[model samples]
Target chain A: MSVVSAEALRERPVEAVPEDAHDDGLAPRAKFLPSLGAVYRAQLSRARVARIPLLFVATFQSIGIMILMRGVVDQGGREAQAVVAGSAVLVVAFVALNLLAQYFGQLRAAGGLDHYATLPVPPASVVLGAAGAYASFTVPGTVVTAVVGCAMFDLPLTHLWVLAAVIPLAGAALSGLGAALGLLAPRPELATLLGQLGMSAALLLGVLPADRMPEFVQYARDLLPSTYGVEAFARTFGDHPDWATVLLDLGVCAGVGVASLAVATWAYRRAAVR
Target chain B: MCAVRGLSKTYPAARGRRGAPGTPAVRATDDVRLDIRRGEIFGLLGPNGAGKSTLVRQLTGLMRPDSGSVEILGHDIVRYPERAARILAYLGQESTALDELTVSLAAETTGRLRGLSLKDARAERDDVLEELGLTALAARPLKKLSGGQRRLACFAAALVGRRPLLVLDEPTTGMDPVARRAVWAAVDRRRAERGATVLLVTHNVIEAETVLDRVAVLDQGRVIACDSPAGLKERVAGEVRVELVWREKAPMELSEVARLRERAVESGRRWSLRLAPDEARSAVAAVTGGPAFDFLDDFTLATPSLEDVYLALGGSRSGVKGLVKA
Candidate 1:
């Protein structure tokens, strides 16, 4: 069939008019800020719910370990000293479980990144909101760990305020690290592998005594952020608090937390643009 | 309103042995220009690998063009992406809603992000869900819905924001015909009531034809044609098809019959002809005097369609060429 040009159609506008054309008299500018907040809350809620089961299991496990350590201390053995050592083990185990849960959640939630990027809001806000939701997930487990450690280890309950401040900071730092990893890992398999490797490294470096390992391994352990976290957490649960060491560890945790958040934001922006 | 001027994109070869040391880059969009007017359903038609999605991404501010400018509603997509985003909603080819979230939550969240109050967001959510015929499935998790239903849920999320511009990339890819029609109807309503401009990227020509005010056909990263569908169909002049059946068995060696048929077709008498205004009179005269054609039965005249124009413009060739001729 022969086709007409736009010039021809323009001359015969009445016959060539599109069937669906219409003129609506509404202004184009409409505020959409409410929907932006709604999208953020929806993403945050999904992250929170998905990690609940893992948080519950990890909390129960920490409580069980604290109870076992308390029983050993009550028996009046050298194992009483092992209680503080066991607390370090519990910290590593809890953080690892939290990281694993977050990594998988992020891998599953990758599709949402594209959706969020397409929105009018800054990509950084979405990343921060998702990280904030993840931090919320770790709160329940962190509180349980601190509470159980103090009750079972005869920790100085008089300084309870310190535990309150330290636990949340440490939890936020760990969650931030998990978010950064989730953003960087190229695929689900890589995320799983890195999560497992991180857990194993944290267990060996933070839980096991550094002096027992080879000189090179000891040096490597000192470089890990979890080593400082475990150290600070152990001091919080001990009878005598070393304020200087605790302050140093807290600084390290805060630094890592900021860095992790920065990395996550950068990754999110890059993903959005590409 | 969105405009892309001198927009271009190139993908580099993968690293290592597969990559040549100094190979030329693969250009995706080559200095293409477009203007999508406000409140119009501008269809972007192209086959696979024709860079339609890439252009959509650039227009939506998801991907930056290698070099060029994309302005949406007078806001430059790259320079003022945040501002542009407030007025635009993008429904990508892939479903972006979380599977764990219920359909209602998804809608509510999208509304909230667009800055609606909690109560107002919920009210809007209810209205959108009902309007999209998704109220029955609103309580279900996204994973539970069928593919078509899931797409509808995403569509509802995009519409919740009530943005002035909507950019959809293959929005009806997996939808059934009924679902596709429903989306088209919603789009129509949005344009009529809200004055929302739409940029739809799709390979579904027939579906696109139903809503597009004008279409731009892309091939190999260049727009080959841009006009109203009827306008495009008029470009292929002198082409016609004639069907004839005889009462007796077909005659053998009827040179006269073949000659007359050829002359009639050349003169615009066969099937649907595209004769120039001057040629039409003479062509009609020649066909009337032909002896092989005593009385033509069931003859119809029609103009070429967008599909025909698509084939004629080197649709099978390699390098990009546009029909808009400057």
Candidate 2:
């Protein structure tokens, strides 16, 4: 009864997956998107019950930062506009990314993946369902933060309708990144630390006026997914916004959202099987 | 019905604190093979680290085997995990409930995941909770439940949809006798009403002995034996145990008692003598009808049982300790 190590097994290449693996005749299999609505509803209810308070905190924290920035920046300028919009989008990142990291991390640490793993639902639905739920929590907070920040900075409130699009776009990018970090981290404590650090990084890079940053720091800001979202919303506050540039920024946000969420789904699949 | 062939899985060796690795790799499951027939309660019996959970995981498609094939109802599960999942329901070794969810919510969500409509899922969840006598605790959050209560809640969730195949890993762990019996009754009902196949993994051999139509005994990632409870007990047949107690004033010296140990395994007042099937009556008569018959307080004959076969098949303390080391 001597046991052989996995390393020994790894020396041999894996057997090719058989074509029969994809056969549907064995049992009545669920479609890839089957019960997505049910999954989404369950996740949303769980988030509403457990995460609403945190959403409020994220909103207040963003507004408080905007009020603080009002003292340094003059009213009705591009700097003020960036401060207002950046702080608002920052709320979405806070809950969607930071909180989600902790949620999935704790889920993995607690053996919660087994619950989803044995279910007939596709892996993508689990990731997307959770991410969508966490992202939804950002909407009320993001909207409240935007309105309060605009009032404090004396920016035009007329263009506030843009937040409807901005909240979801920013939420998708940040929530996906958050879910990936949580699922990938080996330890729950490490995931929490990474989540907090990620939020702080977003605050430092996304909230500050880009003109004042060093050339290299500005490049780092551009690398962040939330920066394009903030820039897209910030441009909308102007008298004559550049529709082309705004669409480009939002498109970048949407593209990064898809990529990050895809990675998160991949991470979930990897963690679940192990 | 399910069949597993050539199932094997190896996990990377864990490094010691000093950084030296013990085994190059640990075979969690080693060339194991098994078949679970329809409408039978099949038991996977083993000590800790004996690959019971590993085998269950492989069958459920939660983990892929390094080398093996799992076919459910003649469909290869490895190639068609989703299809396998459709007919099979798994209650893993770990509790699978979201702490934020209430007991009913968790059960309802599970039913929904199993493809019930919202209304039907809710109805099924309520029915299951009530059937399991957990209706009182249905509104409580999972985090607020005791360990046994949580286990029962998750067990109810698993039973909600009643798929054809049910694989439960240590389902009765940490449960009170009442709750344990409730789960057993539920399992029995599933088998009786639906002809559902149940593959149960458990350390409670005595409890399993009553329900298992067939069982496989695993040791150190290998299936050392597989048979019905009676069939396995029959393997160690012809052996009989006689329990006796001496009269308070009997003339048996310590040395004489030591000599008696040569033929019998003694425990306190009980002497388990190994007598052949034909010799049992005469041996009992000789011990109870001889000169010491008047000095004997009591005597009884005990037949060989599955527990005896289990221990005789190297499922002793040291054997399990070796498995733990691996």
Local accuracy of candidate 1 as per-residue lDDT tens digits, A1-274 = 1122446335534322223222431223323344335544765566554546766766676566557557445522223323443343345345533463354345435555657766655555665555555554555565556656655665544554654545545545655666666666777666666666665666556644454579999888777666666666566545567889988987897787677667776776765566
- Model 2, residue A187: distance off in Å is 4.3
> How do the residues A1-274 of candidate 2 rate in per-residue lDDT, one tens digit apiece?
1122355336633333312223432323334565666667777877877788888888889988987888899988999989888898888888888998998898898878887788777878888888888888788888888888887878888878977778788888889999999999999998899989889988999888999999999998989999989999999999998979988988888898999999999999899776
- Give, for candidate 2 chain B, the lowest lDDT window spanning 10 residues: B317-326
Count of backbone clashes, every candidate in sequence: 35, 7
Question: On a 0 to 100 scale, what is the lDDT of residue A207 in model 2?
Answer: 88
DockQ of all models, two decimals each: 0.20, 0.21
* Candidate 2 - chain A - TM: 0.88
Give candidate 2 regions above 4 Å deviation: A1-27, A31-34, A186-190, B15-24, B237-305, B319-326
Candidate 1 residue-wise lDDT, B1-326, digit = tens: 67889999887765555565655567778788998897788888777778888888777776778899987656677775555556678887666445667899988776666655678768988988887788999988787789988988888888885677888877876778777766887787666555767888877766655678888888878887888766666676545333343334223245544443443322123333344545554444444445434544333334454544675665643221222111
Best by lDDT: 2
- Model 2 chain A scores worst on lDDT over the 10 consecutive residues at A13-22
Q: In terms of docking quality, how is candidate 2 classified?
A: incorrect
For model 2, name the residue pairs that clash.
A4-B25, A4-B26, A5-B24, A5-B25, A5-B26, A6-B25, A21-B79
Give the Å error, residue B307, model 1: 3.3
